[model samples]
Target: MPTSYVKRILDAQIYDLVVRTPIDEAPQLSLRLGNRVLLKREDLQPIFSFKLRGAYNKMLSLGKAELAKGVIAASAGNHAQGLAMAAQKIGAKATIVMPTTTPQIKVNAVKALGAKVILQGDSYDEASDYAQRLVIEKEMTYIHPFDDPEVIAGQGTIAMEILQQVPERLDAVFIAVGGGGLCAGMAAYIKTVRPEIKVIAVEAEDSACLDAAMKAGRRVRLKNVGIFADGTAVAQIGKETFRILKDTVDEVITVSVDEICASIKDTFDDTRSICEPAGALGLAGLKKYVGRTGAKEQTLLAVECGANINFDRLRYISERTEIGEKREAILAVTIPEEPGSFKAFCASLNKRNITEFNYRMGGASQAHIFVGVQVVSDDDRYNLVADLGDKGYPVVDMTDNEIAKLHIRHMVGGRAKEATDEMIFTFEFPERPGALMKFLTRLGDRWNISMFHYRNHGSADGKVLAGLQIPRKDRKKAHVFLDDLEYSWAEETENPAYQFFLS
Candidate 1:
């Protein structure tokens, strides 16, 4: 009986707890992208997320018997908060199961909403399993984050609001995808009512569930997903959402962490708001589409989805925004170790603003200098590289290299001249206390520590670069050690940056 998506959307129970957000024009972003940018201010919702609309709709639709039995749901953050608050409004007991690795800020926020918070495993799947088990034992209704029809219809209201508010001609609407609720709901409604307008979806390159689904013509689970955009770090799209997406969504695009950070800055400049990485995804995709198609003076809309983020994460976002915007260039160049070589390198820069410079002594002939320079455009970086190359300076572009940005820049000096048969590895781990100590404990005390580099990125995880001195004959043992560590890592023994300076 509820199969009519359009009728279900129109008849859905919502608006008591959810606000009809404004569609405001983003001046700064519009100027930058050469398109009239409009933002669907879903971040201004009561819960600071669009999740509330669907959560409340699903909760309100349940009969009195279901409400009396209570409700339970598993989420990394936003959905849990939304469901908890909705249950409170509906006078029902609520329980939320969250990953142990969820940020303290989000966990605290949900707890403050008067929900029973249960910390489960390290991922959403593990937490979800725990919650599902509780539903049977407690006889409670389970509120799904994105898979249910009532929930999708509730989110569809946002599309209805956008069409009513922004009646002007629109070229596209950009939506961010986690389990594909927002995209699926909006795309379905938009394509149904206004099929001429493009419905585009964006996702973090590291956590692209919707993209994976469209590729295989079915849902495909990802082996690993990045945690930077934790809100959308879903490993796979929902069955119901994917079903809707396949019919309505036009394209799925992936954006890097840096691009997401840059888009966050753009959002702040235009609306004076700071959005989480998942929140900025829509804007990031809109910019990418403009760049790819060279589209101009067209009306484009992006859903400013959520504002729940750790305040400390601003530092990491600010640091990478410049690179994302292509305003800064980080490079590795070989220069003579002589005194004048340093001055010559500076002269060749033509007095461009140097954002950073790190040098470590190399072999007798030359040293490698890791430099960061500010430029107005990408072409400026190319010209700088050409000029340095013409002057006989060997240069490598590290502007887009993850290793250089995350690890090598923080490590200015690390050499193992006397330590023979040394091997280096970079690792990423949860940033809790004693995490690094735990990692070291796993490595064992058998091999001597040759080099170590680590620093706080002020995000969810900590990065570490470590070197161990072991004989070539024991390389197989080292491989066995790495497999046991169970942390995300890569060996840099053959990396040129290590070879030129750290070796």
Candidate 2:
């Protein structure tokens, strides 16, 4: 009864490198959603990710002569570590070409696995190119991060385990898609074994290669991809992966960074374990699906795919979780510059917890204050905003505003002195030694920095608010600097919060 892909999955040689991760029910998340949400604990694997299964299967499939030649791969992080560990198992040598900009934790992990590490370009694309060249030159066996038959077959084994583990009829299964390896494998197996179950794929909104491919009915490349969910960030889906995913995958949903942060929190509360954004992506998509469709009580399984989280990322996850979960509302209120107004605003809060309040007494007639307050639900946020507006208070809901969340919340002070022709931008300073220095070095010495504020959230990325003097004549230079910076950035020069306060 098994298809060729399912038969391949059954024959995969992976148990030597992978543990049979557990599938457990998420009681807390289930209670809240009025559905039984089951979690496949792939994060519990020895490498803290499911990549080991595919990596090992692929490497072991090579002939003794091929294995003697060594293995080479290009990965942002997880796949590199997985391949290195796989090589160690088979007594084969491996060379991993990784992005130089990868977090130190991931880079060190691969080195510890006895793989030769080569830090190459700023992205996976560049690193893969370098690896491809080396594959031909060294005659090494190239282990692709995804898109290989052995890797897909190996990943499909997870579906076999899931079928045996889940007792009830599963309504749906949500999986996070990167280069489409995991999703393609799981969907293929599930579609054959349990055709009744729905297979949904999740992706980071900024790097939705599969979503684009599905929309266009062919593989399409994205010019840019978001690195926030670094493990799942791929510019395009692989050719073979797209061929299978188009036919087998049911639906694909894309989630935002904030939503991913919230999903990480949800996993923590349910399992007391934190997952990286890409790891928590399936849960994020499941939540969105439930909310959007107003789904009733149903049996759902979300793959807890990987837990290779950089410890520093917790602060950013915690900070964004509140907004992502709709438990907190940020408001910019225009209060009169008169006394007793502050007390009045406090009184209007109606016993809710005040998470943040920033007021600097901007000027004579009026003062603007940025505030964050706890709320029970989305309706609570709407009601609070309405109440404030009814009281003749001009308010702007900063909850879903990108400019407000990233920049305004941090820039809660006065304007710089005579800072003319100043262009402001928010950037993520990656966590690594000399990274800040590298950023500064790239910024030419000609432009004067008018204002700078940085808040380290103890994560892989530090939030930085930069105001630079880019006069009309030098505006082109600023654009060039940003283009070459190789960092995630958002321009805030035209944000409402900037006009209300910093400007």
Candidate 3:
């Protein structure tokens, strides 16, 4: 089975539309990480993603009649563009059923490539179901984004190119996994050809289907999938992809959204090219690997897979990069509400550059301060907190608090005295037209909204933090309503950020 992939990879005739992507060195990252960091620049593909390789290969494998019958697929973004381009090149019709939550740039790209774009459902699974119906009705050939042998072999070409390009000894090849096609294809080829090399599969923490499947020894669907890295936001791993990957991959590394953001910044610093969150996923895992294992001077490569990010999302990504790199510490410190207390707290900081500072008088005796300070490392952050504690100031480290970073930081105001029995909740919903209205409508007039904050991060999902006035007697009812809402919601009533700044 493994040797079959080697032949399929060799026979993959993708050079017609795919290029031999370059493997460039990341000088600054290499120096900082103390490892020879190399980037497989698959972002430079004709469609700005390696998805084209698999798409074109699968199309080319079809008979003349099949090609003439047209092809259909469900994709978040990259695969749609790849399939559209492939169909255009081969003079066949293509229909791409994409989630309504997909970025406008991707939708426009598919249309520009002469593909019929149909906006469906809020997630890939929903769109995929819609695509299957269309496939039957239109009698078109369904081109799966992953799972097919031709598609897997096509992605394996990247592994083939890596072996040929990097003649030097390599420690590992890091690949990002969605449905597992990319990792399975690459891992099968690499393991069979070079057994000594490690094939590392990187996944976003919110959407690690392959990791879940491997642990269970069977594929299991995730209850909820995060779309921050929309390209890799798959709920379940493909049967074919999981079979190949379970045997070939050496390790699986899952990364946070902030870590992915930091890698995007890392890629931009070295190559002067912006990578989407999923594109930079492999590099994020590579950095974590080096930091944890203390691997040094060894050659490691990460696939920089795509650059199809929305320009507006850069600000949100940039804001979180500092925290991801462990260079910023966000804390909630309590001090006496007296004349000299503020000055004393500042002096205790030892003139460190303060990134953010928020103060509000909570009572006659105490004041809560929400602050962000520049830190060199995680140790430095702890030392700063310890020093503040020694100076008679109570501190709560909020650097890793999702609610604090996303919403509480922006809404750091003293609590409203009238807002009694307030329950805080964070919800994630598809960022489509009338989405907010629909969410509010679901709640109806049952609970009064005391505090609310929403910010669009230019991704598929919209994050909202809301405080509602719900009495203890109606708590069970409120939870029942939330559970039936079908949105990813978390009760943040006990969040320290809310208690320190708002309550």
Candidate 4:
């Protein structure tokens, strides 16, 4: 009677092609929120995304003559790979035009799948323009990534799978929306099959086209889309997908980039699977909603749609993960400029260890020290702040401050110079009992410490700064032994201050 029934049939026909991706119960998430949580692992698809399900289905539905003409599509990454792989399997010629800035890994993958890869402009819109021109010039059938009914129908299969996998009727399902294809398809089918179930579409706050369109009661184009989550960075929603999503989707919510990063880390900790920022959008939305609405009893499902992360980007993800989760705090502490003053500040740290400490001369009386501390929980951060307050120390919490996180951490240590052969090394060490003593014992009397500084600034671990004076003749040998020190040390010998002061 409804389009959901048709969706179910289509899903059945493509069941062999589509992976029966796991709908694992997220016990950690469930216990933390006191709610039942299910994670739909569409990220495990053969193409590393659920886009393959829709792309393949769309190509398979094409008429014989249409297939002969071949297909052209535009995408930044995931969809391009999906369409290319789908077209290859169906023996249809496919041309995938992607932005020039698209990751090389994705470009090579599409080419490996026997698709003609075209590098176009800097963004998806420019690539799409080039793709449309090719479609007209080559007389190829242009496959709309999200707007077409057939494509939407294919994406709708995910909803059918979700219903089949989860035993209980979900109170709400969070779908990450980009051009509205996934959300439109899932919402159209889910609302038809289970009218009482809420369909929430999640989008990055920086690029929330559906949210803007819904507010205006029509399609709205965003001036700029955030590139943090490349998979879901759409400036505009498709015409057909918008039509379906407008009525079917219960709510469209936006989340910050930090929230998405936090969820990605959470997913890794829970499942050991690294989801890209876009893939973690559904989980971010679920967490936001649960925190805001306090819907602890609601049965919630989060669709993890893809896991195509660039290997290099993991460093940035890892760096921001703790701050995103509020587990790490960066603080700027002002302490009196005196020899014993450093020890007094360390004593004030109480039980907290110093993760990082950098001291720079602010004035004659006080030193501006940047410190990093690890907190057991979010509430522990408040406790640390209160402790600092009681100690009469001026502390500025830069935990969520973006500029401080990036520029301040490395520049906190004071300016100093050592001899030409001396090397300034920075080390991060655990702040346990006898750790500092062990470090001092290891250095011994062989290396003259030109500049030695250490501060325990309320972090879980401590950071040490040392300038080792090595003879010009022994520089190479000293470097070799330092490498074997087996500590997190970086050579700052090339730094300008080392040239001017140490040299």
After superposing candidate 3 on the true structure, give the runs of residues whose Cα lies further than 4 Å from its correct spot: none
Misplaced by over 4 Å in model 4 are: 1-12, 376-383, 413-503
Predicted candidate 4 versus true structure: per-residue lDDT over 309-337, tens digit per residue: 77766766777777777678777777888
Clash pairs, candidate 2, are 312-458, 312-459
Q: What TM-score does candidate 4 reach?
A: 0.78
Clashing pairs in 4: 353-459, 354-461, 373-459, 417-502, 418-502
For residues 119-218, what per-residue lDDT tens digits would candidate 1 score against the true structure? 9877788889999999999888999999998889888899989988878798899999998888888888888888899999999999999999899999
What is the Å distance of residue 231 in model 4 from its true position? Answer: 0.3
Candidate 1: misplaced stretches above 4 Å?
1-3, 363-365
Model 3 Cα lDDT, one tens digit per residue, 331-371? 99988889998788888889988899888677889888889
Model 1: per-residue Cα lDDT at residue 28: 78
Query: Across residues 327-374, which tens digit of lDDT does each residue of candidate 2 receive?
Result: 999899999999899999889888888999988877899999999999
**Reference-based TM-score, model 2:** 0.95
**Lowest-sum lDDT 10-residue window in model 3:** 353-362
Q: Which 10-residue span in candidate 2 carries the lowest summed lDDT?
A: 454-463
lDDT of each: 0.87, 0.87, 0.93, 0.78
Best by TM-score: 3
RMSD (CA, angstroms), candidate 4: 12.5
